[model samples]
Target: MNHPATPQEQDYPLSAVPLEARKSLASMGLVLLGFTFFTATMWAGGSVGTAFDFQTMLLVLLIGNLLLGTYAAILAFIAARTGLNTALMSRFAFGQVGSKLSDFILGFTQIGWYAWGTATMAILLVKMTGLSQAWEMPLMVVFGFGFCISAFIGYRGLEWLSRFAVPAMIILIAVSMTIATNDGGGLAGLSAIVPSEDMSMAAAITLVFGTFVSGGTQATNWTRFARSGKAAVVATLAAFFIGNGLMTLVGAFGALVYQQADIVDILVAQGLATLGILMLFLNLWTTQDNTVYNFAVAGCNMFRTRRRKLVTVVGAGVGTLLAVLGMYEWLIPFLILLGTFIPPVGGVIMANYFVAWRARYPDLETASLPAFNLPGLAAYGLGSLAAYTSPWIAPVVGVVAAALAFALIHVATVAVKERRAEMMKPV
Candidate 1:
């Protein structure tokens, strides 16, 4: 396959980002923070908030986000070290052709997120403004395509939007939280509140972790541009651990105070409908662009093309159609699948890089790889199965199972080959 001789600025979808093109910690941190500040995460938080007391809910959010942050940070460090995103890294674990499986899985999940966000933005606009119900579908198409413009411009576009949006979002969140605390009767009233519903700790953690695990797996797209592994790790941890944790906190707080999980609804109840709508737009747009950009990167790897802009537009179109067809309702099941299947990809990639490649991959342009890597494929399958049936935290189970399976399979395969070679020697 012919790789591009000269890559476009900041988007090296088919190749590693060069050292000169790497970015600072604050740049990557802002972009990732924007991506993690999502509405669905709030919805997931709302679910957990209603299920437990405030103290227990805080514990669950902490544990769940810590797992997510650590997982993403590992991938981010590897990406920064290798200058390759998850899709490109998958080529080593899953092989050149087999990597398409990850491309599809990762790309499709991002499309789901894009569609959900698009549908959400349109639906809420209509609900809040008393626009005709008929306007929702048209609005979805308009917002869906509009959201991809930043993604089409690639990393630079994402950085510009995030710089403005992240701070504005933070301010909005702080305002909403202050109002919520006062309305809930402050610390005494909050502590006095009891759970109105029940959920297992495992399930609650899953809800928190599962909501963004897929996005975390693919965050390497931006993390690959980090100036160093330390920068990547710090930025990713801040985004997933703090940014995502804060989102869940807001949602849960809203749920506990007003029996509403969505931040927009919470704001509306607080008589900040104007600011809430603005927050909603900023929240979804930041994440929507990133999500579509992710799909474009995965598509580039899948199709072996450097036309990321073209692929981005196509991805938005597909997501828009899905939104019109009712993707908003699939949020729960989608998160569950993401939590179960996606972590194993990261697991296999970690094992492949650290164990097989010894923490260094050969230059992508010169490396010779097989069409398929059977050991990696088998390990992923086994890992996914372990996640499916395990009663513990499924995402964590999947990652560990897949990594162990890859190691054992590699060792066994090498031993058999060595024995066969010994048997064939002249005696």
Candidate 2:
């Protein structure tokens, strides 16, 4: 098969890999900087802080976020090098045919998240509006309309939303942290806050790891626009470490200041209900837009359909219906399960681009699509099975299993190919 010409080598490029308007380091930094304040981390940190001392909670938070952030940065670097979305990149690793399985799994997981996010936003809006009873229906309509519009605008709009949301979140977090610190009666106040005996260290660890690893599903999507590998690494590291870390810290402070587990309630108690509403709106908007956009893209890819706006509208409508039905609470367990389900896809992608095809091709822009490889399929299936079966292993087992499976399969394939070539020696 003929190798595709590189972006630098192509004459009249038939496929335009969507080019992101080149952003500055700071703008890119903000985009990557969301990990510090993910809603899940905020919830988990508050929950953990209610039980453990701030120091203990910090230890777990640091370890989990650091490890996950590092892994994400590495994956982002690979994604930047290839300039392919996660699912498209997986095709090379899992074979064009096998990668569809990966796409299906990821698409399903993201759709669930989109539903959960829409539901959460509706609930937040209901609380903000303070309408007693009969608010669910209106909230669902509002959520459906808002989410469909946001998703229809797609990635370009999301990039703009991130720019506005990230700074706003930062400022709100600063305000919330300041208020919480004062309300807690200073750093000395944490000592007086009684810890809950029922909270286990394992649970806290799981919460931290689960929240930090939750973004694994979007690894390639975020990094696809990166101008260079360094850009991707920097963006991922900054987002996870600085952005997500600070958000969790604020949640911990919220727990220490108020005896409540809910961070939003704590903000309301502090007379900052408006700020709380804004933060929730921004958080949900950015995250939900991402979910809907990815769902639309995946849907388009699967059906070879061009109805991006329709897919987004349909997805948002479904999510809104679930919200109206009050399924948000029930969906938490499934979201956690999805957290485990996605990491193996990241592992498989990482193994393919960084290991199996590393030396063979300088870049995806110039390389021929790799042959259909069955070993990659087997590895992904086994890894997914392990993730499904081993609930206690958190994310490591699936990641390791997927990586090893891909590597072993690729090595065996290469060796077989080499032996076949030698047997057909030329005169």
Candidate 3:
């Protein structure tokens, strides 16, 4: 049996959550991840692939599905067993000071994504309402207000939103699929359409990978609530392979069948406007909520404060202001740039959790925060530089470059530390 809590334990208050709550939270994680996959993959696969042919588009889906699913599984396993968010877990690898840098960057970026998502959802709602496109202001107000209300209710409310959003996405996709197949002469016609000559294998791969790179960072947030590492791995793989993979395939198929690259326009053309609006609404909401929640947790951890609710509200407010200013309209270029930065950070975290600090400190599992590790910082910097400089690699080039840089840096650090200790020994 576990020992009674010591003062240290009592003061730190590790997540001694009930089993039921853990299960619920895990379910929420799965749903939220699934919803994110649906939103991002559909948008990318449908719209971005317009320039490509059917075969090239399918290839992109294949590469992205495999890479994201595999990476997420590995990260989820670490998160479930450790029960630590990305920032907290980073201390084991990145040192306390180093972790702060990464977390701050991640938190700020997520804030931008949250605001952008809200605005995009608002725009889609306006379009669906058949109101004048000029109603963007009113739509922005409605979305911002609704998001603030939901954020006020906190994590539990976010979980409820996930539950509703996931099913709504499924139904919308199903309805869209049905409409597309019926209208486009089914799969036979879709298969016959060749893509443009400009479409290449590389572009497809990049598009698919780009869609889920940001999501990889959130693995720890969800996995920490899982019942076990096994559960985390299973949930991550299932959600990505089945949920994400299928959605992208559907989007690709929709693009082929309709010869319409824009996902929103495809829905309108198919007379599935109602379902389209619902998809747009739920997709944006679920992702935005997750982003905001993650940002709040990061803020609370960084400031050593207990103002999660307040911070979330403030973050949401900032995001809303950006949305109203029409920043979301330029989300594509921004996300592309953001994507370049994501892989390196994710690589640093993954290397720290699974390699450098793995079981070296048994007490780490229950520790609230560990001392900052400098090696983690070196690895992150090297990785980021590689991603920024590499021109040939577009979509996932950063992820690969960063992973390699982290592993090399970590090994060198360990070697130097060993040499120093040996030199200082008194024989």
Candidate 4:
């Protein structure tokens, strides 16, 4: 691992964040809230909202977000204690050479998100304002690179943007929801709405959990800066559980009342088209930068470089190219893949930290790790298999399967070593 040479690289792509660099609870919370306040999440919520009655939708939201928050909070706690992000932590669980697998998977997902967001921003802007369709690609290129500006500057830039953007977005969402409730004739009206679409409870939970599980997996990037373990856990729960839940609720509300899942579309229908445009920009920008930032962090680990700013620019370009190539149309399938594959990485890391490492990872600078940790990789494979075959809560199944598999392997290996030692004694 190379030492970070610039202030921007102090995000420590290849190393642990030092104590002096840790951030306050508020800072971590705000940045995470910004990440969770995403448009896609609302779209996911809308899918659930249209399928179930209001009361059932709320129950599904609570269960799904609580599970997502718990998963993210556990990883955040490890990150804060170890001062390492998911990619860096993977070195211990996946081994020196094998960690790159996680790097590529995590990095690829973030780039996919970046491209989707870039395309979304461009397409939506053109449709909402009646711009010529020809301008969409050029706008994708522009916003693709533009959103990474703060990411290029690193954590300070992210925190600064979130400080302003999060509060503003929250206020806008609240205002929209209030208007929606009034138009729908309040609580009785909301309760009176019947399900218009058919979906199983399992599918609804999968939609809610799968929508952001990939992003949640990498949230350690921000939470790793927490000043304490408690700070990390609290901030993570607040963002994933409360902030994300609110986004889902807002989307569900809009879908039920206005028949529009996207808050932007709902706003436009409400004669707030101007504010809708503003909300779209802020909503996508907040998540776009964070997504690109996550890609850079994984890029640094994958390439073993400390130049995060360079990686950020390069990632934005790749994402832009993907957007131009039609990444926007791939959302549903992409999400299914994310739900099936991404959670196992987090599962392996949790098992590596608690069971294998006994809650302590050695300093990366001097640790003697193997080229590949066979058990971890095997566990990940088994976990992915379970997730793919499972009918209910695929993400949760993947996580538990991976963790349990790793622990089982650890026990078997220990027993083998003990047996060999016994046979060799006094011989």
Backbone clash numbers for all candidates listed: 0, 7, 5, 0
Once superposed on the true structure, which residue ranges of model 1 sit more than 4 Å away at CA?
A: 1-10
lDDT of 1 by residue, 1-427 (tens): 2244454534998889888888989999999999999989999998887888878888999999999999999999999999999999999999999999999999999999999999999998987787999999999999999999999988889999998889988987898789889988998887777878788999888878889999999999999999999999999999999999999998898788887566567777988877778888988999999999999999999999988988999999999999999998999899999999999999999999998899999988789999999999999999999999989899999999999999999889989999999999999
Each model's lDDT comes to 0.92, 0.67, 0.67, 0.90
Where is model 4 more than 4 Å wrong at Cα?
Answer: 1-5
* Candidate 4 least-lDDT 10 residues: 1-10
lDDT of candidate model 4 versus the reference: 0.90
- Top candidate on lDDT is 1
- Model 3's lDDT to the true fold? 0.67
Which residue pairs in candidate 4 have backbone atoms (N, alpha carbon, C) closer than 3 angstroms, thus clashing?
Answer: none
* CA displacement after TM-score superposition, residue 250 of candidate 4 (Å): 0.7
Which pairs of residues have clashing backbones in candidate 2? 32-239, 33-239, 35-244, 36-243, 36-244, 36-245, 37-244
| Ranking of models by lDDT | 1, 4, 2, 3
**Any runs in candidate 2 off by more than 4 Å, and if so which?**
1-23, 34-37, 197-203, 212-214, 359-372, 388-393, 420-427
Q: What is residue 90's positional error in candidate 3, in angstroms?
A: 2.2
lDDT string for model 4 (1-427, tens) is 4454467567888888888889999988989999999988888888788888889999999998999999999999999999999998999989999999999999999999999999999988998899999999999999999999989988888889888889878987888889989988899998998878888988788888888999899999998899989999999999999999998888888888876566567877777777777877888888999999999999999889988999999999999999999998888688888989999999999999999999999999899999899989999999999999999999999999999999999889889999999999996
